[model samples]
Target: MAAVWQQVLAVDARYNAYRTSNFPQFRTQYIRRRSQLLRENAKGGFDPLLRRQYLKLRSQLLAQRYGPLSEQSSFRAYSNSIRSSRTTLDRMEDFDDDLRAQGARGHRRSVSRGSYQLQAQMNRATYEDKSPGSVVPTSVAEASRAMAGDTTLSENYAFAGMCHIFDQHVDKEVPKVQFANDDKNRLACCSLDGTVSIFQLVPTPPAVLRVLRGHSRGVTDFAWSISNDVIVTTSLDATMRIWATEDGKCIREIPDPDCSEVLCCTFQPMNNNLTVVGNSRQNVHVMNISTGKKVKGGSSKLTGHVLSLSFDSPGRILWAGDDRGSIFSFIFDMATGKLTKAKRLVVSEGSSITSISARSWISREARDPSLLVNACVNKLLLYRVVDNEGTLQLKRTFEIQQNSSPVHSIFCPLMSFRQGACVVTGSEDMCVYFFDVERATKAIVNKLQGHSAAVLDVSFNCDESLLASSDARGMVIIWRREQK
Candidate 1:
């Protein structure tokens, strides 16, 4: 019996010792290739410039081998792609109610601020929300039929939900909310508090990542740089400050002591290094971002205060909407990088122009028309850019429920629909309306309602999958489609 036990113990000991001894060898063998690759990458012996050239050559070779898609096929593919990729992703609205309550209690009681951790509790709101005027389907088949029903704007869009009020941070209204074209997850809002706040969206409710504070007065207008790295903002403080979004630091500040206020700002389409800004006065200053000074021969003038501006990338024109409902077109010279006055068209006699959104070049120049949408007082007028002469002809007029956002308020003048299929703007009646410009009649599609007060500004994210709208009362709501 003792010999039998000794034999079993000896066998077990041998098995354990062998397993332990071979483990490191097994791991080394499995990870040897990965270790070699890491060492090679870390050695810094490879030339990045040569690698880039090699990549370019490899891409050219691949393109030559595969060839380019036919023009017709490319157009068809792009148009179909605009329908949006199918996404099972849904939004959970009011996801932070419980979190807000818990945070309130923590603030009142004795506990760490960490006790207010609200992220884990929040959730996405499911189901499609029909807007106030949208037709609601009766059944599943009806819903399908409704979705396939019309080119009408309402059927295409549904209100996803509202944004969690970060009103605790500031008392002023949020005028402009521009989504970073480069980063879909980020939203930048210019407030009257003299601070530009950037919010990160992703996990249910959005979290305020950083508050870019620099302007002594209110930040009226701002935009994401073409590269999406910097945020450019114009303020009543008489300065246009560019902020690095990643670190929340002001990279450059262009001040105009010669003028009272820098009211509007936009990055040049061809030359992003050049920033085109319109002041409260007659002058429009185009500055060099690198040196933080106005570019030589870049300064131009308008008869009235420049209320809003848009860039025509294809035509190389800068379009400015003045206070008296006049459209001013400035020829942007690529060679000299200067803006020279092209033409001016006055649309309304006394109505003040609030906002202007420029449309891209017509793909099928004969079939498709390039439009410049301008909002004056409560009416939105669509003008077609006729020719190289920068001649604009009146096309369509849309009547919104009179916008009440302050005339100087960035939100008041223009409804934002830069990278989307339809034109969207809010009315004083607290309704969001979408106009289908593709339609011959410019048919009204949807009248979305969620805000209780007048909505100030509306902006769509890169893919137009998500929309963020600000109101005159300092509330912001983000909407997503029920389904992809």
Candidate 2:
């Protein structure tokens, strides 16, 4: 019995050492390679033989890395070995007690690091199956349909009329509107009036829940945290403020290190404690919101004033677009939050990029990771993310009037099971446009024409029941999807 206990102890020690030294590096490399292969496979351009070759290569790589540590000596196996080798019932109870204590500590660590949410987000992004039942990209829509009924074919074309119009920031020019992550009813928008209004839509007679006001100048952009507990907003005042959603109080005010107007900001999808902010001085920074300090080696200079920023679903890659019409990609270090610049694509000379949205899976029908971009070139561009290094291949372009306004667009939230996916964009033509992405020509699917001014931004709630669009004239229209 003593010998068996000693062996178990030794195994635990070895596993701990391996986890501390090698597991992290191995996991990073393995995920990187897997993501690259997934991108290649999603393109659907490779023949069966080449696909088999890729699969074989992946198997060999896994074997080479995991061969030394077999399943017999894994963490789970160690626990089972302990259970089997217990000499008496008392010893088994003691082992169970030890496991309970260890589990408590693990739970504490998971909470502190917010790892559970991160893991869930990663799983949704990387779900392999694209079936109607599979919830890779549109879990909310699927869940909504499951609760209510399956969406009908005519429902896809039912976004024509407006349900509500918020004119509180009248004539102030609202630049952005966004629905909270994983939420079906709540949404927020920032305006040139220097305030952010959060709205609740569930109850009848939807109204603004709270107005967040602290910025000295026009609020440029804002991002909601993963848990929707707080919001971070950038402003023309050259400061970024974190606001508590519970009471709409300013928790922390962080000034830009360069003392330039902060143009845009986004929460690092995997880490709410970290936010990526773009400034008018041509700098992109990764900020530790908890400490209100910039992460070391996480700052990079762009070719022009950084106008838009986006991250792939996993948060491994960041794409930032500048006023010079160039989009630059950077590799984001998940552990340290460091950024390494990777690739760049020039859309057009002197055309400002107004928005960048990255979607890993546009729909179950279209599995390619795509970037939806709005620039000053009078067109909305769609590009396929081709490689792990953040290279982009232009796939399609939809014409729109986007000559001057800082217009934005988004992938429809409930498009996963639709026969064809759709993208919605705010246009300078004073309209909201939806384009069927799979259509080869005449791709316009639906148009909402209530906004009298150039539409600046668009957002959809998690279930796609409500879409909120903001225009340049400070009008926010909430469009309801007609149920058939």
Candidate 3:
């Protein structure tokens, strides 16, 4: 027994060496390799000894992977789990009740924050008028047919009326407005007036939280970090600025390397530390926001002035549109932040490509990854993502009054519990349009009126409780979802 114990220690020491050498390979093949090592070492009496050593190694590995089983460590992990769950639930309705129920579930809360986030990513099936919508089906089939049987905007969304109109950028064309990724009640918008306005929606009456001002020219675009702690904005002033969200102070200002107007910007979905920026010089550059430097091999040139940028949910694919009416796809290297141009699709010769949005899945039933595009060709285009290379095949087109303005559109954040999919876009005809992508004859599901100028952009809160649209006249309207 003393000799056997010594052999076990020897085997564990060898395993630890292999683990230190190649941690990832050690993790995946530890069981098989460790067993072989144990058998080879104790060839004469390997049965009971093998079982004992295997169990011991597995236990030690688990303890190392997850923290030690001490009471303080366990309590600390539990508190972190609770905090992560709460942050995720903040985007949902009745989160307080959900948090309390999660607390009661106790021992089942041992999963990591990544697991909780994976479980929380689902389609919104229903909602209350006052609260953001709720409930996703437990299974794909159920989620496909959860709410209304069809996917028409008229069937799914009952917009009560405009909840509020913010004219903070008065007389300046409001180019963009977006809700924070995690907080449903917080949003911000940028205007040609060279300022960005942040707004808070809770506490009854919505009001401006803070106004960010620094650009010498019009603010072209902005993006919120995934953690909601920072915002990055581009401007015609030939520079980009990062702002701390808490105090709305500009932290780092980077001038475009090409000394041209920075036209657009977006944070890498999987990594907030890397940002993709487009400039009027027909160049797109991936930037390291932390050190304020352009990443090596992360820059590419387009045929025309780059106008818009979008990344797939995983940040593995990036799509950029240019004023020459071409959309180009690039493979994003997650580790090095390098970009490899993959394919290009030209919709028209002289028209400008204004916006592009990529979705991994349209609905539970129709699991095809799709891209929504807005080009100045009098149409909104939908393309099916046929391969991992981001090659696009035109699936459908909905007629809109798009001509020249940099109009933008977005997929309804919460997919309706229906068979079809929906997309919302602003039109140059002073209206907001929602189209059922599955409908051929009458693709127009609903048209929102009251914008005094060409509608430039549209966005929806995380839960679909509110929809915000901005226009050329600098008006931003917050529309409420009606309760049935």
Best by lDDT: 2
| Backbone atom clashes (below 3 Å) for every candidate | 11, 0, 0
Please estimate how well model 2 matches the true structure, expressed as its whole-model Cα lDDT. 0.75
After superposition on all C-alphas, the RMSD of every candidate to the true structure, in Å, is 21.9, 16.5, 14.9
lDDT of 1 by residue, 1-484 (tens): 2112222222222222223365633322222222223334534555656545544564455346555444323322222222111110000112122335556788443323322221222111111122211112212222123223333234346555554554532457676787775245778888877888888887757788898998999888897765567789999989889898889999888787455788788887655677888888868888887888887888877777777878753437778876666778888887777778888887776555667666531111111234445455576666666655466777666777664353221111111212124567766778777775545564566666887677777877654567777766667777775442
lDDT, candidate 2, 264-343, per-residue tens? 99888767789999999999999998899999999999999999999986688999999999999999998999999999
Hey, what RMSD does candidate 1 come out at?
A: 21.9
* 1 against 3, candidate with superior TM-score: 3
210: Cα error in model 2, Å: 1.0
Better of 2 and 3 by lDDT: 2
Q: Which TM-score value belongs to model 2?
A: 0.71
Q: Considering TM-score, which of the candidate structures 2 and 3 is the better prediction for this target?
A: 3
**Which regions of candidate 2 are displaced past 4 Å?**
1-154, 360-365
* Candidate 3: 10-residue stretch with minimal lDDT: 125-134
